[model samples]
Target: MTQLIFINLPVADLNRSIAFYEAVGATKNPMFSDDTAACMVLSDVIHVMLLTHDKWRTFTDRAIPDAHASAQMLLCLSRDSRDAVDAVVAQAGAAGGTADPNKPQDYGFMYGRSYADPDGHIWETMWMDPAAVAAGPEAFAAHELTPV
Candidate 1:
């Protein structure tokens, strides 16, 4: 079977969290979801499991940190173009998330933007030229991409 990644997050409100994820392009996987947890599919290999505090405690005893006041881990999702990155971030904001929690990044060959979910989880959307990536970081270090 192909390797997959499931990012589990503790959410304050289950239904609202589900709506937030769907607005950002993920689809709910009912098979793995329940009243206390939801499985959101981002891609074939990427899934997000949103769990309530009570349910989260069943997995571990770690205290649920306030994501709004503390930084957990930054999560990034790649997009096909700069516009796509912008679109996702915009969609997130329209759906009640905070857009541009951090400054946008534009390096000629790449672009990125970020948003914070209602629960304060930060998700970054980025786009990089495929050819530039194939050429490797060494190539980029040699010279900056010419502005298009």
Candidate 2:
């Protein structure tokens, strides 16, 4: 069987988080959703479990970090093209989320932008030419990594 990835996030408001993810194109999977948690289907292999802070505590003893103050991780999603990346960021902004909290990134063969959900979880939308990626490190030799 193929391995699937499930990203569990602690959300302060379950419904709001569901709406935010739906706005960004994820559909709620009712079979795995309930009052305290939601299964947001990002793709066939990628699912996001948005759990209420209370529900999240049941699984871990560690305190939940203030996402607004510190970033635990940066989640990135790839798009088919640069326009698709920009479209999702725009959708995030329209959904009461913060768009491009960091500077946008643009290389000749790649591009990316970021957004912060209402709870301040950061997500990056990116697009890269498959040919460029297949070319490997040489393709990025001239690209400088700047803070973004």
Candidate 3:
């Protein structure tokens, strides 16, 4: 099979996490979900496995980090436009998320803003133009995210 992505993450409360993901526009997959975990379908090939803290720990011997104190992952979603980014962040806020205390990053062709989910998972909503990517990451240094 071709390589696909399945991001596994721990959630303190499965039902609560499910609600948050739904608010962020993700659909639920019954095939891989039950009382212990919920599979959030981002795309046909991309799945986010939201597991209970206990179930998640079974996958590894390592202790689960305190997500609120330290970011365990930075989940990013690309949008079609700047407005789309704003809409998604607004939706997240309405769903009990908080905007990251940082200025927006504008690299001429790409722009991004960050937010934290209720469980403190970091998420960056971004809009990147192909033309800008071709210009290279260096192109953004001049238009770096300056604080307001």
Candidate 4:
């Protein structure tokens, strides 16, 4: 079988998170979803498990990062077009999420915008063309850039 990723994130409230994700167009995977968690289908190979804090603590001994105070993880979604990226960001904001008020980036090959989930988890919506990206870092710009 091919490798598939299941990213588990702890949330303070399950239903609220589920609503936010659904608003952003992610459908739930009923096979792994239940009262304690909701499986958000990002793609066929990618599933996001939104677990309640108590349920998530059962899986690990490490301290869960307070999402607003420190970074636990950043989720990125790639859209087929620039407009799709913008649309998702807009939907997120209208659904109680907040889009990062930053300028749009034009790398000649790729573009990206960022948003934060209701729980303060960072998510980036981006678009990229492989042919342009293959020209090397310098092909688009002299420096590699990362979100701040």
Deviation in angstroms for 67 in model 4?
0.9
Report lDDT (Cα) of residue 94, candidate 3: 84
* Runs of candidate 4 exceeding 4 Å displacement: 101-104, 134-138, 141-148
For residue 126, what is the lDDT in candidate 1? Answer: 90
Regions of candidate 1 where Cα sits further than 4 Å from its true position: 143-148
lDDT of 2 at 69: 92
List model 1 lDDT by residue over 3-51, tens digit each.
9999999999999999999999999999999999999999999999999
lDDT at residue 86 of model 3 (Cα atoms): 85
The residue pairs found clashing in candidate 1 are none
> Which scores greater on TM-score, model 1 or model 2?
2
lDDT of 4 at 114: 77
* Best model per TM-score: 2
lDDT over C-alpha atoms for residue 140 of model 2: 81
The TM-scores, one per candidate, come to 0.94, 0.95, 0.85, 0.86
- Write the number of the candidate with greater TM-score, choosing between 1 and 4: 1
lDDT of model 1 at residue 21?
97
lDDT of 4 at 81: 87
lDDT (CA) for every model shown?
0.93, 0.93, 0.82, 0.83
The candidate with the higher lDDT, 3 or 4, is 4
